[model samples]
Target: MAVVEIYDTTLRDGSQGEGISFSAEDKVKIALKLDKMGFHYVEGGWPGSNPKDMAFFQRIKNHRLSHARIAAFGSTRKPGVPVQEDGNIQCILAAGVSVATIFGKSWDLHVTRALGTTLEENLAMIEESVGYLKSRGLTVIYDAEHFFDGFKANAEYALATLKAAVRGGADRLVLCDTNGGSLPEEIAAIIRRVRDDVPVVLGIHCHNDGELAVANTLAAVRAGATHVQGTINGYGERCGNANLCSVIPNLTLKYGHETIPRSSLAQLTDLSRYVSELANLHPNPHQPFVGSSAFAHKGGVHVSAILKDPRTYEHIDPALVGNRRRVLVSELSGLSNLFYKLKELNFNLDASREETRRFLEEIKELEHQGYMFEGAEGSFELLLRRAYDNYREPFKLESLRVIIELKENSPVYSEAIIKLTVGDQVVHTAAEGNGPVNALDNALRKALEVFYPDIRRMQLTDYKVRVLDEKDGTGAVVRVLIETGDGERSWGTVGVSTNIIEASWQALVDSIAYGLLKNNGR
Candidate 1:
């Protein structure tokens, strides 16, 4: 089987995404991860664009990589300057990489209007720039910018541009759909034409404006391209670039093309989450293959059949992508669903079927009262433990009070006082924080540290709020969910109240209780 090479640009093009930025250290860490993951090429950044990118290239000199070659990206030499004299060329050389990728204009309109250079001069620039790089003993990959749109407008000019790169000693010619609006069939047809005409290796670089970047890139590959360029998680300018997370699985699993090692397929979900957290971004729930909701079942009938045989509802085993099937416990759950959840909590169900039915009914009533189990698995586990009489109280909440002081000309200040009992000893603590929720969390953790020093190892990682009954106006019920994690494990708990502080406090208390219980194996 022929293997297509994957070139990841998450640290380069991905950083171009709006509201996204990665420091040089962050770029180096992600680059190291990609290298270990077996990407064929990793584009670190454009050396001249920013100080951070320049620092990245300088810092990577001391490291060793297993599988990936670092590629420095830049444009072709300026319209008239000698290739050796161009600042972009100098930066590319300073990057100290074995391979360099340079993009040149393929459209006549761009050459004439944007570049203010004749089409023939632009062609000469392409040839001279690539020839100069090759003359320096560096492998060059030429990017033919706007190839698809240019081909539609003037097929001769676009093909000429690619031919110039090939004639000038480029090892590969990457045809780029820079604007990212071309369809799969259009990409396939153009790639086929180029493959027949240009003898050099063909590659693809696609953006995601039309949401067809992955489709178009795969189509180009089917038409004989061997190299694929994309950013991890689809982070890039505008609508973003093709997502390697989506492309890698599609190629290896669906199309039987070898890119990443077959055994590494199972690490997809963890890899996705790792990158998202490192970037301080949330993962998209609808993302293919590795999303949290990728295999979630909620409808009663759907869950019923899935419980019998998951293949009835699922397209593939989620474990293949490092994700697991999740049966959502909601107001719609039946007795079978309750039993399934109980089994997960290691609770033995009684032989009385009526009791199970009563449990399901009560779950629905609680859900209607603003309890949400989907995001509060820890709370659900506690409920199951209580139902089976197997739960032990880790600590007792003696009292919790929030005091707020408001002045006419001063900012309001809130302090939380928490009193707790652990093993016949009572501890009291008070703290001030930005809000009632933060203050309460601090006070509780402070008081608990005396008894459970291990509490310092955990933290509240995420918090979310939902309005359960908007029709009730100020009297509407609200649900709060808190996600906590130690270095190894993560759990979530939920609480509901009309008062926001109360809801937050309830979830916060459950978070600590669940952590203690799990730590002690209670």
Candidate 2:
């Protein structure tokens, strides 16, 4: 299989996305991660553009990478300026990276309107900038910015820019869809045309403005481009860059081309979510290959088929990408959904049993009352174990009361007094919190900590509320969902009631109970 070089730009172009900001340390950490994953190149950042990038290049030198070469990104020398004198060009040299990626204008419009330079001067800039980097013992990757649009506008001029880079001894000529508006067919056809004229190794860089960056890149590769450039999770400016999470798997699994090592494929999901964590952005659950919902089955018919053969509903075995298959149970589920869910929870109930049928109906009835178990698997597991395995509650709630007070010039005060029982002993506790839910949670924990010290490791990560009936206004039944994590793993539980406090208390109790159960290895 032909190998495609994987060039990641998460530290540079990815940070251009709104809401994404990677510090120098963060960039170094991500670079090390990519190296360990066997990416060919990691574009650190534009050293000329920011101090953080310069610091990243300096700090990354202390750590030796195994596979990926760090690449510094910048533009070509300014028009009419000496290549050695241009500050941006000099910064790439000063960054101490073995690879330098420099982009130059291929569009005549950008030359006249953006750079206000003559066409010949732009070509000179491209040639001189690449030559200087190469002379400094750097592997030069020349990015032909806006190559596709420029080729459509003037094919001869775009080809000329590539030829200039060739004259400067560029190691690779990367054709860029800078505006990200090209179709797959357009990319394939243009690469065919360019292949006949330019003699350097061809590469591809695409944006997702048309929602086809991945498609366009695949098209380019099939049409003869060897190098691939993208960002993790498609983080970039505007619509974002091509997502390597989707790209690499498509290349290796679909096209029989090699990218990162096949054994490292299982790390794809973790890497995607890890980058999203540092960016402080939520991972897209629907993203292909590596998302939580990519291999999830919910419908009755689908779950039935998946139990027999997962390929019936899933495109690929989710385990190949380190994601697990999830069968969701809800009002729309059939007996198959319940059976599959039970099997996952280590229960093997007969699907045809009368009690099993009754339990399925009960779950449907609960869902109709606004208790959604799909996002509350912790609650669902408890319900299942109780129904089939004769499970006992660890603690029984006796009563609870919440108080909220506000004064003229002071912060609002909230307190909760809770009473519960463990075995034959009754426990009473009082605690203060920021709100009614927090107060209830604190008091509950205070009451139960002595019996189950493991509860201290559990922390509430998310709480969500939804009004089930809007027409009733204040009298509407509300649903509360709470997500709790204990460092290593997380679970979600849900509750529904007309009284907000009651709903919150139910969810809070389930969250803690589920954590305890997991800790006990039950």
* Error at 62, model 2, angstroms: 1.6
Best by lDDT, which number? 2
lDDT of each: 0.87, 0.94
Q: For model 2, how does the per-residue alpha-carbon lDDT over 1-522 read when each residue is reduced to its tens digit?
A: 789999999999999999999999999889999999999999999999999999999999999899999999999999889999999999999999999999999999999999999999999999999999999999999999999999999988999999999999999999999999999999999999888888888999999999999999999999999999999999999999999999999998899998999988989999998899889887898999998888878899999998998888888888877888999899889999998877887886788799999999999999999999988999999999888988889999888789999999999999999889899999988999999899998999888888899999999988999999899999999999999989888899999999999999889989998999999998
Candidate 2 residue 106 Cα shift, in angstroms, is: 1.3
Q: TM-scores, in order shown?
A: 0.96, 0.97
> What TM-score would you give candidate 1 relative to the actual structure?
0.96
Q: Which regions of candidate 1 deviate over 4 angstroms?
A: 350-352
In candidate 1, which residue pairs get closer than 3 Å at backbone N, Cα or C atoms, i.e. clash? none
Give the poorly placed runs of model 2, Cα more than 4 Å off. Answer: none
